[model samples]
Target: MKKYLLIFLSLGVFLNACKKSDDDLTPDKGLTPDSEEVMVQDFMWKAMNFWYYWQADVPNLSDTKFPDTVEGVEAYTAFLASESDPGVFFDDQLLFSEDRFSFYSDDYKELTQAFAGISKSNGLEYGLVKFSDSDDVFGYVRYIIPNSDASTKDIARGELFTGVDGQTLNVSNYIDLLFGDNDTYTLNMADIADNQVTPNDKEVTLTKMEGLVENPVFLSETFEIGGEKIGYLVYNGFTNEFDEELNNVFGDFKSSGVTNLILDLRYNPGGSVNSARLLASMIYGTHTDELFLRQRWNSKIQSELSDSQLTDYFADKTNDGSDINTLNLSKVYIIATNASASASELVLNGLAPYVDVVHIGETTRGKNEFSLTMVDDFEGSYVYNPERENQINPDNQWAIQPLVGRNENADGFSDYTTGLVPDIMLEEDLENLGSWGDLNEPLLARAIQEITGVTGKRGFEVKMPLLEMTNSKMFTILKDNMVLDKKLDINIQ
Candidate 1:
């Protein structure tokens, strides 16, 4: 089956800097757009224009047209003015609210094109595609790209995308074309049903494994290659609670006989910056304080890590007789992929200075921006509701919040916006995911080769559908045997 995962853009402080106050008695009108308010308003207008053009169902626009400077603005303005039948006027007082919703015709087109690419890439069977406008609080249209012919289209679908003006775009379709379609089918799942491949009989064929044990605490699962010790562990998400869980996971690894580690952050989409610091503390040892994740705000120089609550995170560096400064590993292999993003990239890039790092996978999604804390003025109570919001409130008067105080990396580096590239880059055979586990694909194969000095057979490239339809027999099994296992204890009363 083909899965359609949605691509999301996080709101940076810069994103929310445009909360204009109509209530202001003295509003400065500058011809040469200078202040943050202008940028924000311009951003919203441009975003609207993007929707207008996309919905025209015309050809895909060039990426170069993205507004970058004052000159670009003149060009866009001229384009709009040149249109004889300007459907939407340049000076049209367009107000974006949470109530109305629509989709950029082009966004849907892009989604269609992406789906076609994914279908061809994964060799999946296409089903009927449907699109509809969303009735969500935030304005957006939902598009459902199904994998099978029978899947139903529900208004209640998936994620929402909001423009800079707080106008949200609902998924007209339930499938996030990037992940998998609801009704798509993959050759592997099809083959498994047809009895083409059998399970790996629990035969532990993987033998040789080597890597530095930076976070000595992650040795919970023992690999046979190390001759009987839980040397390495791999987890997906770094949730808010992961801070404490990570310490325990790492601490347990050290005492359990894990001398090395290989952190596999292939599909981690990122969560919890504090958890990221907590992860850093394990390998950073004592000097973890020095490694900065970066500063937010326009005047980054004014920010410092000590100013935030995430400070002294590794405050108790002394664990048993071993401190962060004293703990050392031989080598660290960070397994990555095109999907490894945000917090995942943070760990990979943050620990680069002190470790012998090896990255294996496609280029990572570049993202840098922590959620800001927002204090909204509740009506006229003079009470600012303090809450940690993803971006700044539309109202400029509200305060911006951040977890990391500093504006740089732990290595004293700056400008960490585009994300980091790995030292040893390895492309995975995309087609192989059908026959093997997600991490057991070519990327991992290459990482293992680099770490263990083994030159195994090259992996075959096979494209599988992003999503597939498993019958109720399989679906019931998944819900009962898989999803539930992670939560409730089945044996409990």
Candidate 2:
């Protein structure tokens, strides 16, 4: 029940002010709305009108599209009945063509749980890469969640799978084969060579369970190499609930007298803005007085908000008020990939103005626009409020995570839509995706090389470039998002 800065899409909040500033967001709930779809459509339109970042740009979402009266309600009833499915209307009609990350869900319960890192998963977080020159795809294990069905099976990271059940995986059947309605599936293992993939004798069966909570902190260890105490953390997501646990990892890093840190955000897709801020605070010094990030909503919101209300500052403690462990380093080495997005990108961008961020991986997933979580709670201006959950229309379990703002660092730079380019270019080698946290791993090896000026210790060669087609986490809501959180509680104009 974490409260988010009411937004939509995959954008994160840049609310500088987490203060509560209520506005008169009372929308016409459609006095004589046609049907259930009309009701949901009415809610969607109103939410977008007030909070959507491109509301001004989307002609359909224009403030003048409908008057703020009973006639507007009648228009909503009449116009919405033309479309049968709310999801279709949301996608085809309401969303902007340029919008890449905005999304709507039928079930707010599942969506919120996803933001909390809870979902029905086999525990295998994998990425699908197309074979050298064929449409045929091979899946490689990224990481596994503790106590997941995959965790119990005989599977490990860097393992390759060419098929599901008995069918060979390809560009078309993979959706139904892997993420389809079937609860249980067997992964047909494979062996990789010079661009050739061959099926092996091993098969691992995994079943999806209810409410699998994954800890974003995959691994945290300090390495003593070349007279430098370096910390390596493989953080998968920015799940807010696990913020305390993530903070504790830094606490351990702090105690170990680690001067250098290698933040492995190669698998992270993003989570809470607060969590990202906290992580930034941990890496950089917690200067509550200094700015961390800022927000730029639609012009209407921009006009309504004061300068301070649009900016967020670095915090000295967690949301729970525990003192944050700060490294206060001048430079940090970051491990990124195409999967690194949203809040993951935020940490690097936000810290760039302060700390020297050495990005060492593929180009990141470009999702800078921050979104908010909104239910059908119109009285609260479409903002999802935990205290007002019961008040939310029970008939409307639908929720919209819309792009409401662009999150910029203190210097007002959020233009990474194409993606944040890396300082060092390196892609994951599929032929030898070495063990996680091991120094011999390609990404880590490069980071260590940069740290201690040791190059020849670990082989740095790209046997075969991993051309990623898709991934497991990308299918989830975690992919390509920088959604909203408490920062701007400004009084809506």
Candidate 3:
């Protein structure tokens, strides 16, 4: 059955080539020497025309505009030839107002590595902030990946740093100070005196390294409170590479007879959709055949894919083909913020039909769309096979992660463009942030209180620092039109 599906997909691609009407511009075959500069551009147009969710919105992409006629072929050929850089040309063709998640990648290898939770970094995730009513800027550690230099130096989350290499961080140099392409750098610690952040004498040097695999399951533990076993999991991302480890954590929770679950996704900027489905199935053990998420693709590709294939269902197996450890919980407690997006929201929305989801913390990063990593397969380089082994395209490194479909639950409730509002609106306790698994943490404590019927002490009210922008207008413009750092693979094979 899977073999027939692959043949059907290949035939579809061949049919797409027949519509081009130009021998030199055969997209299904490789690109010609004359079209080498704009090969990626041509690929982008054809791929998006077939798969993009907003293909109907883009006039240039419409079949009527670029039909099989002689004039239509000329128009498309001219359009592709005009752009020197295909990445920029592809961006200009997208309906930016509705398509924010689609992106072009110059290096597909790095992007693929990121999907597997492997990347080049110093393993320091931090947030930049400015003091209230002042121009002073600082950054605080969010979390450090284990086995990284930052983790080795004991750089814990919520620890403030005022400068890099003894130079004070300001609005002008903060970005370079934190994210410069340097192998080694010093982070000068800060002292919080009377709510004011100042540079302290302590400093930590960090060395950046390549191929750092991030462990997404940060903390997982089971607690006994009020005679009910409560499980806590601070999951950072939905990387499929860690699916077995995630199931092991759930297996422990199930063994401990956990009745309640607290899922901390405050800083999680989502990942793989298959992992999300596994997580959802682990929570709702009985709904194996129920709809997990329905994908709505463009009209062109919709004709090729069946409704059953497009709709994902709850499965008791991981993406790596391992059996899932089910929890069978009736209710779930999720702590989320604006960073929780993509697959994170999929898990939350998909489980709402069967589970009593108690949401806490700020609103979620409303992203219901998923993207497929599209690489140039015409040259047989970077061609994705079902078996997961493929040759690299060192010459042509262009790839795209386009917003190909929107996600909906079994109830078809996916109107969260503005974001998912929290049932209990409590901001993160920045002033007194505790370790992830500790029950003393404000967000986890609140979830435990809600589960055990005990009132916990509230932390001090701390305002989230805003970006001290030197150019307010530019900042506003960028903020309103920035692509978030959340990607989901729909696995449209």
Candidate 4:
């Protein structure tokens, strides 16, 4: 009787173990947060693993052990359980409404004070902390305290301090404050509303193209050549509209006696890659091997567009006369600055093989890929986060993406981290410019020099440049004029 009881008990334990194993392999429905947690953990693990897989062949984050790295499958499982959720300890009171939150809210404030004290005690620069309302919580966390040790370097974000009591107080910003262009105060914008942040007096001037569609192509002989005409075409922004504009511009440039082309992307914050490709084709006369620009992400967040899968994306583009295999190339001088990014970088990479591309001004902001659109559960709106994208080059390897793929030049040699150094570097003349304009216009002058071989003056000053139409003006005018004058006809007999 004892032997039979033991055998039954053993069988029961075996069955329970088998059921647990089966549960592990089962497909998860969206019924529990476990599924969400698993998805995020899986992505983070894959991201780390991808780094390890490529590290043997690429230049990347050193294989040095991270403080976060864990051992054993169970340990790995436990670590992810803690780290996956960013909103784990969200303060319901401090969310949404601005009035409930304060600079002295919680431990964050005390943490900042402690960090400030440390800075002053060491006689180091008290890193400035600026504060403004922010759309993203994590974004605020990242931009300010990018890492754990960030407080030691700059002013602490919100505040997270050590538990050591009565540590000497370092002088720091009471709250992150926005002050006029001052070196002493690091700008804090974690609290400003999107609309409120936009400067009412801010000026944006557009030239070359005139229409609702933001495709601008302009011609100018303002830049001179030696007894010959050098035409200048400056288009700063890149968009789908710009793509359509490029088709027309390239078609015109081929026919017109336009020997030199200048693309002014100095102030462009970046837009669409389709436009970047279009611009690349116009400059690079032929197709080249894949170019790496940036990374894309596959986040756990649900995007409206995610519902439309990649298979559908390819199919839809086919109907719209887009075949991914083909590209155009033409000779162009792409003007760049530090502000240029993402698709703008794509333009540079795509055109590198075809033209004597000269990147002027400063190094570009190296965001190379489109972000995944994540709908916030609380806000019910879209937010963007970077993603990893694969771009196989002529060497059949990943392109220059920091922390992921290999960084390489067009020659297939990896080293594009500080970004593609300009063929000719020029410093912006801040005294002569109101904003980041074509202060040096080095690319423009170079394009002229390329065609005419004449060295022109260094910087052309524009003191009272035209103020662009404001949103209010545009809106008010539209409201008053129900029918556009161009669209209406007065044909009353």
Candidate 5:
């Protein structure tokens, strides 16, 4: 049965690739070189018209405005070709004022790799915290990858850096010093004294690598407290490739007879929808046939899609055919921050109807919409070839991840534009930092207190009033396609 299933999957992929290749073939129209460019422009417009969630807001994409006739196609294509850059021209048509997730990428290869949890990095994820009443900034290491150069150099989480390559970190040079194009640089460590961070004498040299696979499962453990087995999972990203690892963690939780779950998504930026659905299934347990999420596309496509095709249901197994280790719990605790978005929000929203979700920490990032990547095939069309497993356009090197749908749960509740409010709003205790997976950690501690009905002593207080300041600069590094994601594939093929 498993062998037959594998064959069926392979055949499906083959048929989809063949269909995409046939779709890419353009009609033989005797036209000039400029007209060829116009055809590509038309391709972009049509793709957006059929799939974009905000298609109604885009006046240029309306079928009545740009019909599929020779006159309409010629006029629209000529206008699009007049722009200096077609990519920029495509961006102008999107509803940027309200839709911030839609983005254009010059290289689809890089974007596709990013979706698979692979990227160029020194294996450091940090947040820049600026001291109040001063221009000095400190880089706080969040986590490091296991095989990265930074990990080899003995860089640990919660370690602060005051300078880069001996240059002081100020507002002006912070961006360049941290995000500069240097292959190797020295990090001047900082010392925390009297609730303040200052430059220390220690320095560590680090080198950046080309491809690093980001391990999304940071930590997972089952704890015994008051005869109840509590499972803790610090999941950072929703990358689909890591679904097997995620399921394995859940398998351990099931084996230990976990009664409650604490899902840590404080630093997670969302990824794939398939992984999110699998996770929802693992948590809810009995909701396999229930609606997990519904994607409401633009009016044109919405009318064409059946009810079943537009919605995603909970599944008993992961994408790999392995049985999911479900908890079957009535309540669960989720730790979130402003960084939690997309699939993160999807899990929180989708499970609300069935479970008593006790959301801790800060408000969510408030992105209720999802995006689909559209790449150019260089043959004046957007192809959805399954042969391109990662769905990357190797030819033109151009792609657009546009907001293709707004997601809703079984209750049809999708009004979280601002953000989902936390049940208990407590700031992250960075002043008295505790290691992750430690039950004494502030966020995890509070969750344990709620579970066991026990109030433990709090961490030592520090006199850092300025640490409460919201650092907008911390989120600057995440302003890319990495932040935007989808609930499912919108490709018709």
Candidate 6:
């Protein structure tokens, strides 16, 4: 029932039924789409055709593909019959080939819960990295969610895991081995020596909970370093459910007269775009008149919108009419990595024109587009409407989080497709992954050095910098997505 549905940091849609017959261009495992599936398929195609950002580029989504005549209705029906699975119909037929962020789910309820920061998670947040130049992969625990199975176990942050259930992890079998049906698994522990991984002969077992809700505002504290009040926050997601709590943290920082802030977004995948704006407003001044972000939709959607509807100015209040806690800082220090994406990247991109964001760590996931949560409503646009939930088709509960538009700043710079490059490039030292909030941690320490002009224990240089193959966050229900909390009512019909 929660309104936050951008819980996924990122996900990949896999539908493999090679170039087939003319009508059955992309079937799934030779299965034909039934009548019910065909109905659901109709919604998928219509939703993409009406709202997709790259709708103009995908020829299959052309308006003329199925005309408005009696014969065209029959042709549209035939077109929907080709794909067996609704997901495949969405991925293989409707989506642009370059689209990596658009995704769909069979149950909107399950997906919405995840966006609320609640999911079935073991709570061991980690990143998978290849062993320098080998097929073998290893994982390092980034952080542990409190009240989770991993929190109950002896496993903690910086712990290296080489295998699951005693089998060594490789690129091919890792996905199935970790994310497969088994709810419980033992992580084979290992340690790095001279930059090489060696099994430590220890293991930690963890189990997934049914409804684990993660509070995105992980750690917030204040410290006085070099005579300046420094506020450090480890934010994991931009979940709207925690918007008030997040604002309160900034309120605390403001009351404490914090002059400098270190925003740790190393693992945040992203969430609601509205929450992103609120978080940005919290860091920067709440200048309601100034342009905060600009939206660019498909040509059809663009044509109907006035400039006021597309442009988002920095807000002075939260969506619920609460005054936003303002920092009004001229500069901010951000810590990120390859895992940082969506709303996480939005904070960096949206604030660039105003604030001086000193980015630390590796390149980000580089996702600039924003998505909308669409469900199978009576209308073909499939836009999610809570008031019309009962009107959704009984046979199909399918929902899509499609990239409907891209957000740019006041200066019109939103080309972070490759990723936001770091000004102070630093990677987490696996052998010495420091505890959270530690000023001596490699990434934070660098930021501290920049702020305080004094350094401490900066000896650890990243021997073989780890490039994340994919992390545990990337496989979650949300997969990196920046969702627009407000809905668009463009009349496509």
lDDT of 5 by residue, 1-493 (tens): 1222221122223223333343422222222233655544554665676567777777776657755567765676666776757567777754446887777666666766777778777887777777776897777777887789888987787788889998988888877777777778888998786776778799989887888888899999889997778999999888878898999998899888898999999878777777888888889884668898877767655664557556888888777789888888789999987777778888999999999999998888788887666665322224333345444334456667777778899999988979889998766655555688988877888898889987787742434422432232233223322222223333333
Which residue runs does candidate 4 get wrong by more than 4 Å?
Answer: 1-224, 227-231, 286-331, 366-414, 434-443, 446-450, 457-493
Best by TM-score: 2
TM-score per candidate? 0.45, 0.92, 0.84, 0.42, 0.83, 0.90
lDDT of 3 by residue, 1-493 (tens): 1232322133333333343454322333322324456667776776676556788888877756655666666766787877678777888865456776677778776666766677677878776677666666887777888888788895788788888888888877876766667779998998664566767788899987888888999988889988879999989888777889999999999888888899988877787777788898888884677887777766765565557566777886765567889988888999987767777887889899889999988787788887666666643222233333254344566777777777788898888988898998877645666677877877788888889887756643545432322211111111211112222222323
Error of 3 at 188 (Å): 2.3
lDDT, candidates in the order shown = 0.36, 0.83, 0.70, 0.33, 0.71, 0.82
Name the lDDT value of residue 4 in candidate 1: 19
Point out the higher-scoring one by TM-score: 4 or 6. 6
TM-score order of candidates, top first: 2, 6, 3, 5, 1, 4
Clash statistics: count for each candidate: 57, 23, 0, 38, 0, 8
Count of backbone collisions in candidate 3: 0
- Residue pairs in clash, model 5: none
The alpha-carbon RMSD values of the candidates against the true structure, listed in the order shown, are 17.1, 4.1, 5.5, 20.6, 5.2, 7.2
Error of 2 at 9 (Å): 18
How well does candidate 6 score on lDDT at residue 480? 92
Candidate 5: stretches off by over 4 Å:
1-44, 60-93, 134-136, 378-395, 459-493
Clashing pairs in 6: 7-478, 8-478, 8-479, 9-478, 9-479, 9-480, 10-479, 10-480
How much is 272 displaced in model 3, in angstroms? 1.0
Model 6 misplaced regions, further than 4 Å: 1-37, 69-74, 487-493
Our model 6 lands, by Cα RMSD against the true structure, at: 7.2
TM-score of 6: 0.90
